[model samples]
Target: MFFSVIIPTYNRLPILKKCLTALEHQSNHNSVENYEVILVDDGSTDGTLKWLQDHQLEFPHVRWFCQTHQGPAAARNLGVQQAEGDTIIFIDSDLVVTENFLKAHATALIQASKISDRVFTYGRVINTCNFEYPTAEPYKITDFSAAYFATGNVAIARHWLIEAGLFDTQFHLYGWEDLELGVRLKKLGLTLIKCPDAVGYHWHPPFALEQLPNLIEREIQRGRMGVLFYQKHPSLEVKLMIQMTILHQVLWGILSVGGRLNERTMAGVLQWLINQGKPQLALEIARIFLNWYNVRAVYAAYREL
Candidate 1:
């Protein structure tokens, strides 16, 4: 199977370098005829396009396109339009994979296609903060995901995406774009096949107190996008996914003390956890307030509509 790996990147040049380098070094597989990496730069101010152009020879498998700071949904649509391969692999620019990454996906996909073409391969993503040795990090329980169609590490036939109408451009915010497409794909009777051998180490900076503002803002954006997702599908599943139900409101409200235990109120405790070399733990704890912000924002957006 010829695969087009669609990666949407922003100002994440440092990890994007590692991500592209890993893709270029994938092991040969008979099931995989060839593969190309399509890097769509979402108008990054970090000179991502220039750096790629300068080191073009280093990543011969890579072809890049640029947009004017559009969100990932639009960038991915552009990549799919430029893709020539029959299969499309969607991954973020921060995810660095092992040498057999494509081979694993190709092998699994080819096997699944025999059973039915209505199948997509979902890979494992291990989150890590170790930039220097990202792949060295072992899998953690917190890294486990139950998402049906997260764009972090997934592969499907290109035609299926076209059939589903690609991603909605209205999801110009932070989240729900991929899963919204998944909803459409589900209606098309697509089955998700787990491909755990295809592993990708998702790298991000270690949690810090200073990053809370940006993280909080991201949750808010996710909440707004959640409303857009619900508007399209308007299903019970979408309501649960977006945390728009009364149960979500009560759960987060009680956990966060009705928004009383916010970033400002919990800053000292979060910093203490960070100081104790447990940034991941700190981030999990901070999610209490972060999710509160998201739930509140979701209701606010729904009310506005």
Candidate 2:
């Protein structure tokens, strides 16, 4: 089946270069006839549009589009609406994949369709900060994701997305849009077939003290949007996924000393870890309070609602 890889990007021009170049060089080991990369820019303040325009010759397989500052949920919906292929692969602009990425997803999807039509393929994503050689990074325990259907790397039929009502554009914030779509897909009997061979190296800047305020804001946004997710589904699973449960409240509360051990309190320790060249560990440790911030935000949003 032909593939349309839908990627929604914001101000991520540097990594988007690697992501698009990787998609451009994908090998057709499964003999897939054609694959297109649909890049929907989410109103980036950076020079992403001009750069993509200038480097058009480098990305011949890309079918690019742009929208206002709506979140990725709206961007992916636009991509799916404009996609020319039957199969659609959702990925972030920060993910750089191997040459066989599309081929692996296509092959697994074709095989799964033989058994059942309602099936999609999920690929591996390894996080790294090395922009020079992102693929060289090895998988770590921190990289393990138990998420059943995150959009970092997953392929589905275009028709299935339309049937599931596409992504709800109400998710105008930082998170939970993809997993909310996953809930609808799950109800439609879609099976997730794992394709570990199709790997994507997720690139992000190393954690620094300067990023704390933005990171904390993202957690708060995620918490608020997560409430929207549960408002739509209103199920136990959605509640758990959004960390809206009392258990999450107690867990993060105790872990963060009822919000005292926060970014301000732990700034020195986090900075020391970064100075010691352990940014990942620093980020993980910072999550202790970040999660508490999220839990508090979610509860506050719930109260507002």
Candidate 3:
């Protein structure tokens, strides 16, 4: 089957380079007839478009489009509209995959299709901060995800996405656009088949105090978008996912000591963790306040509605 790898990128040029390079070197396999990398630039100011243009020959399979910072939902819709492949693979620009990634997805998809066409393949995503050697990072327990349909690394039939109405452009924020689309796909009786062989190393800068502001802002945006998700689905599951329920409120409240143990109050402990060479642990600890911020933002947005 032919595959169209649709990647929506913002200001992640460094890792985007590695992501594209890895896609460029996919192993030749019988499962895939051919593939194209559709890199959608979400109006990045960091010269992503120009860099791609200059190195066009290096990534021969890559075709790129640009939009006016419309967010990943819109960017992906544009990619799907332009894609010629029957199958669509969605991945973030920061994820670098192995050489057998496409073959693994194609193999899994072909096998699943024999049973039912209403199936999609979800690949593995291992998060790492080692920019110099992202692929070398081993899979950790924290890398495990239970998401039904996250765009981080997933492949599906192009027709199914069109049938599911693609992503909701109303979610023009940091999160939930994918899971919202997943809810629609579920309504269409789509089944998710896990494809562990198709691995992608998700790269991000190591957690630090300096990144707290942006991280916190992302959680706030995610909360706002979560409200939008609930507006679309409005199920108990959606409510729980967005942390709109009182359980979430009390849980995060108690963990964060009723918002008293915030980024400021926990700065010393987080910094100490970071200094101990445990940035991941520090980030996990910081999630107490981060999730509290998200819960508060979710309620605030719901109230506004």
Candidate 4:
């Protein structure tokens, strides 16, 4: 089957160049056919569009499209519309690919198709070479569901994806959209498979300890989305467990942590609790903290941050 590797990028031309170069290697593979690289320029102010055009003459297999400053969700949907391949594989621009990455996906689909009608595949990162970048790993993959959903690097049957509907553009930012898709696909009874042989090298951003405030804000935004997700699927007990577990950990941090890091963690948790609408629940969180430490000191620091 033909393969379509869709990459959605914004203002990261250098990284995109490396990704496309990897795609070039994939196209040269003997078994792959009618393969094409769909590069969606998601309203980049950088010279991304110019570079794609210049490379158009060089890589005839590459196709380029542009949209006004819409997010990656919209850009990917556009790429799906234009893709000619039967199987669609998506990889983030700020990544490197193994030689067999695309081949492994194609292999999985062909093998799955022989036994079943539906095929959804995902890959893992063998080693992340560039951890100092923003795209570096934050969440633990081992914690991911058996459906093995991760947008960092994955492939799916084009027909199956269209049937499941594209990503929820409503998310509009860095959070939960992939989980949203995984939940939807599971509800539809699709087969999700993980391929360990195929790997992607990710370049994640290096976060400093002093950046706790900004990180807390980002988590707050993501946490809000997580609440919405749990609200929709009350049976997903893991979601509730994670929320309560984080609260529990922060409480432990207040008593056990001695340095600035522990203090920051406790402060951040309290800030998160205050923004939450449930005052009673916030009080409970505070009570949990008090269970191990001086309630008055913890309460004062909680309010200070």
Reference-based TM-score, model 3: 0.99
lDDT (Cα atoms) of all candidates against the true structure: 0.95, 0.92, 0.95, 0.66
Write one digit per residue (lDDT tens) for candidate 4, span 1-305.
Answer: 78888888888887777777766775355556768889888889999988777767777779889998777778888899999998888888887776787788777767787888666788875333353342243435533444346677888878877887987776665556677777777777878778766677765333233444454444545555554555556553535332434464465566455323343446656566556644334434443433333322323333444
Tens digits of per-residue lDDT for model 1 on 183-213?
Answer: 9999999999999999999999999989989
**Clash list (residue pairs), candidate 1:** none
Candidate 3 lDDT over 123-170, as tens digits, reads: 999999999999999999999999999999999999999989999999
lDDT, model 2, position 11: 97
lDDT of 3 at 132: 96
Off by over 4 Å in 1: none
- Give candidate 3 misplaced runs (Cα > 4 Å): none
lDDT accuracy of residue 136 in candidate 1: 98
Model 4 reaches what TM-score against the true structure?
0.72
Better of 1 and 4 by TM-score: 1
lDDT of 2 by residue, 1-305 (tens): 78899999999998999999999888756458788899999999999999999999989999899999999999999999999999999999999999889888888888888899999899999999999999999988888887878999999989999999999899999999999999999999999899998899999999998999999999999999999998999999989988999899999999998999999989999999999999999999999999998998998999998
Q: Against the hidden true structure, what lDDT does model 3 obtain?
A: 0.95
Candidate 4 overall lDDT versus native: 0.66
